[model samples]
Target: MFPIRDHNPSGRVPYVTYTLLAVNIAVFLFYWFSLPSDFALAKFYYTWGVVPAWLMQGEGYSGLITHMFLHGGWMHLAGNMLFLWIFGDNLEDQMGHVGYLLFYLACGVLAALLQVAGDPSFDGPLIGASGAIAGVLGGYLVLFPRAKVDVLFIFVIFFRVFSISAWIVLGIWFAVQSFNGYAATDDGVAYLAHIGGFIAGAVLVLPVLMRRGGAGFWARNQGKPPHPAAEYPVTPSRIPRVPRR
Candidate 1:
């Protein structure tokens, strides 16, 4: 199951979120297409992406922040940006542009540190905005547990969209990440980073929630977006009709 969208709409335009999307896409395109060779790309990633061992050695300390802006491929970039777009606007609305930006970066840094702690000896470069996005997911869960999120399920050719509670979607996602982090033996995916980022997001949002009246806030808003839900029109399919002979 993949999330298509959420019912919660931001009160104001999420300038930070939009800027982040554009910047990530632009950075990925520039590096992905302009790199001359695989070796050169590897070198570039080594410089920018997190290498736990290198970090432990007091080198590449900047990778924690740089890594989040880099992605492995189109799918990697697309997936992260999709999550950011869906969850980030509401967060930006609540935290304001500057505060939300700082929160995002803090979660990302903490996530990278946790990943490094998970296996400080591993030297492979870790890249992607997933850690930070996972943090956003955590924050969203805390602030909008009752909000509706539309998830698209695909099984072979069968396709369906289901509207479910944010808690369910985020809960399931956290469970999967936790299980994977425990069972993972390979270095390809940084499940630990995802876990760490999620925890950070959840914990970090608590202060804001408290200031907003905490349980009282939930009671008042019913854990939904403060603004009216945005309506999107479903477009008709454009398949051409076969003329009867």
Candidate 2:
């Protein structure tokens, strides 16, 4: 199942979220076009992407932040951006632009540190905004546990969309990451980083939630968006129907 959208609407324009999306895309495109060859691109990634071994050696420390903007492929970038777009706005609305930006960066840094802790000797480049986006998912869960998120589920040839609560969707995601982090033998994906970032995001957002009245806030809003849900026009199916005898 993949999330398509959420029912939560931000009270204000999420300028910071939009800016982050633009910057990530621009950075990816710049590297894609400017790098002379695949080898050159790999070299670039090694230089900028988080390499735990190098970081442990007190080198490439800047990569903790830089690596968040670098993606390994188009699909990687697309998936990260989609998650950021969906969950980021609401968080930003609650935290304010400056606070949210700092929160995002802090989560990324903590995530990189956790990944390094997981395998400090590994030299492979760890790159992607997934850790940071995972943080957003965590924050979203804390603030909007009952918010509706539309997920598209595909099983074999059958496909359908289901609206699920944020708690269910994010809870399952966190569980999967934890399970994979324990089960995987090779240090391929940074599941540890995802777990770390999620925890950090949830922890960091606590003060903000408390200021907003905590349980009282939930009681008032019921974890729904503060604004009216956006209206989406329904379109009639265009596929030709077969007549039945």
- The lDDT per prediction is 0.92, 0.91
- The residue-by-residue lDDT of candidate 2 on 1-245, one tens digit each, is 98889986789999999999999999999999999999999999999999999999999988999999999889989999999999999999999999999999999999889989988999989899988888899999999999989999999999988889999999999999999999974646799999999999999999989999999888888986576776555688999888999
**Candidate 1 similarity to native, TM-score:** 0.94
Error of 2 at 150 (Å): 0.6
Model 2 ranges with Cα > 4 A deviation: 185-187, 239-243
Clash count, one per candidate: 0, 0
TM-score of each: 0.94, 0.95
Pick out the ten consecutive residues of candidate 1 with the lowest summed lDDT. 225-234
**Model 1, residue pairs in steric clash:** none
Supply the global lDDT for candidate 1. 0.92
lDDT by residue (69-114, candidate 1, tens digit) is 9999889899999999999999999999999999999889999999
Which prediction has the highest TM-score against the true structure? 2
